[model samples]
Target chain A: MNDMHLCVVNITFLGKGPYTFSVGKGECVGLTGKSGIGKTQLFRAITDLIPAEGEILLDGRASASFSPTQWRSKVTMVPADSSWWYDRAGDHFPVKHKTSLLRESCMLLGLEPEVLDWQVSRLSTGERQRLALLRALQNNPTVLLLDEPSSGLDAYHTGLMEKYIGNYLRQNNPAVVWVSHDPEQLKRVASREFRMEQHRLYQIK
Target chain B: MDVIALTGVDLGLAASLLLLLSVLSVMLSLGLERKIIFFGCRMTAQLLLIGLVLRFLFASGSLLLVLLMSTIMLLAAGREVQARQKRKIIGLSGYLISVCAMFVSSFSVTVLALVVIIQVKPWYTPQYAIPLLGMLLGNTMTGIALALDRMTDQLHGRRGEVEQRLLLGQSWQEASSDIRRDCMRTGMMPIINSMAAAGLVSLPGMMTGQILGGTPPVEAVKYQILIMFLIAAGTGFGVVSAIWMSGLHLFDARHRLRLEILKSDKV
Candidate 1:
């Protein structure tokens, strides 16, 4: 767990705009902000979906040195809206181990294995979000970047997400960076948290 | 009635039938119903005007006039290609290259085959050269435009996936192979369709004309076979060259697909 250091060295948004934080390995860091405060943009930038001017270091290696694909595989992101091109869930997680992981994840999130074969187009917003979380975890990424993972979920589903994520963190000790507006959810899943306001990150006790 | 007299009247009647057929085609396929009437009208007018000019050029029997007409044909083909491809092709280079290559190859084949092989006197005669050139150039222009447009659109649409492939250690060619294959398939479809229906479903224009001009049925069939082969060859070459030339400009030095360059606001 303490074998590596995951460093987000310096990420600047819109030429000095909001919410940049660095988290170490085996730590769960939560980001909170009002809507439209550039939290999503920051997630996209970190994932290299949007261009950013800074350095991201994992195990002391600069992120720019790694190609976008390699960087993404190493540090995976589950966006707020998990849009997928393929219709089948099996298409996303093909391996048996991955399917098992997803099934377990679904059970924890109160989803059924039947949902795996269901067409993604038919999945509700909550179902898609839960499936996205499972897909992200299936990759066994070094650093997981999640943007509002439980936003669309009901209270029951939200509790399931927290339980699964909490178990995963305790068992795997992988670095998790979560973005959410809900304080209770943050208190449950996050070991440390910060608030983004007016292009700045303020540490929240 | 004399056999020769009957033959002459038959020719006139056939010409009238062709004229009527063309008008009916325009009305049915286009008319005022389709919003793309402008393209149809332009095609009709261009074909008629070219036919009139070609008639005079053939009668005059001058090499200079034939050359002038050929140049005009190339220019029109170039402009049509450019107009259809608007933003997909960034500079004038793709248009110029495609048109020039199509003109050179098709014209060369027509001249060498018609003059040297068939031994037609006044090798630069418009009667033989103009119609052949028009067919080849028209198909090539269409093929090039489709290839360029499809390639550009696919590259832009799949930018994320392409970049992901690149980051996964795929080279530029490897990353773009799928898109390139798709574009090539799109570009070659018309030629393939025409080839499929060459003899059975429709009598090609050249063959029908040759038969109307009193050439033997066997001779007309031979010319049709030769011309069809030539057109397919010309179109294939044009599509490959256009795709190759345009594809070079689509990527940056880093081998990444350039999104800004390929972006079409209109699309």
Candidate 2:
């Protein structure tokens, strides 16, 4: 693990435990848990979407000092069921001048550059999932909180997503906390692993 | 033109028309017999009560009384506004929001009209103040209620979409901007539709009343035009205020979308 950017300092989520964890720059921290164990709720809390106690820090700065906008930008969360409000996928992303990086991201994910032009309604679940990930990456977030990012993908597409995400990770050096059920994917992607069981935090590896 | 007065017999004849409606409901088996009878009685009682109260207020000619009357009207409107919402804000915020918004819109507009536009003898004369406020407050209340209703429902129903934008580095304002604008527009629809259809479809209530009371055609038209504009202004301001303030309630200091501010929407 490189220099730590994302640190969860005794963050307690609804009697779930004073959760203590950290993800270093360029490291993907994978979390596995049984369904209904409040994984999504924890993401929301970290995003400050729900009210929770305990201090979260980014690069040695306290969560309290940072405005919600600044905090969310630094610690962007990609939800499992990604939301698309616009007619076209391109509208969801920020207006940017750099196309080369975006195009490279598309190519890495096996998507054509014109995929951004397609309407959200026309995109398949796999396509939407990948695009949602790409959209979040475009924001240049410092800490990427991914919730089951590749859950909907088949083996081939999942591989492409993992590959593209891995590429983005290396380039950006962002701290990542990924929630996934697949152990094999965890083994491939995560350097450190933790299992959430019965409201208790256990570090497996 | 001489103003015509309705005698007691004439009033009795109007009351008899309601009996005919009750008979029709019974014959049609529409299950509206109880509702029709109750509505007729309620209308009679409400009209009598408002008429007596206005009469006493106007006779006394007290500014405090006029203000008190306006407050009572605003509070009643606030309760109605609270009742209309499908997704209500918990406890006092709902009442506070609607009442404050309507008070700002209706009271301000009524004062401006009385002092500047109409230039009545006294600014708070009950004769001018009560009727004008009644009309303005009624419209403003509906507008505020509709805006609040639509906004709450939208926020609750489409949580995922809103949270997505926020997660993508948009502020709470940017994330919910579309829904807010759309809700305000929806709130103002009744007033806009009324204005559009006023001339072509049917005579509005104020105009029709003036005409029947033997006001000249042009005179009635003038009064109706002024009233409509007043309503439009009041409703517009009221809708804008409620929806914008409710946005504050929806998002916390952390800029999180707190649908839990609503009483029913736990998810």
Which residue pairs collide in model 2, if any? none
Model 2 TM-score (2 dp): 0.95
True contacts kept of each: 0.03, 0.85
Candidate 2 regions exceeding 4 Å error are A1-3, B1-32, B265-267
Model 2 DockQ class: high
- Per-residue accuracy of model 2 over A7-82 as CA lDDT, tens digit each: 8777777677677788888889899999988888788888888877788888878888988888888788889988
Lowest summed-lDDT stretch of 10 residues in model 2 chain A? A1-10
Q: Which one is best on lDDT?
A: 2
Q: Could you tell me which 10 consecutive residues in candidate 2 chain B have the lowest summed lDDT?
A: B258-267
Per-residue lDDT over B1-267 for candidate 1, one digit per residue giving the tens place of the 0 to 100 score: 222445657756755655676677677874533434455557758867867876788789898888888888788888787677536555666567667666666677777667776677777766777777877888877887788778777777776656544433355677777788788888889989988998889898889877777888899999888888878887777777777666677765445465555435374
Q: Could you say which candidate leads in DockQ?
A: 2
DockQ scores of the candidates: 0.12, 0.82
TM-score of chain B of 1: 0.78
Compared with the true structure, all predictions reach lDDT values of 0.73, 0.87
Query: Which candidate tops TM-score?
Result: 2
lDDT of 2 by residue, B51-138 (tens): 8987888899999998888889999999999988888999898789999899889999999999999999888888888989999988
Q: What is the TM-score of each candidate against the true structure?
A: 0.69, 0.95
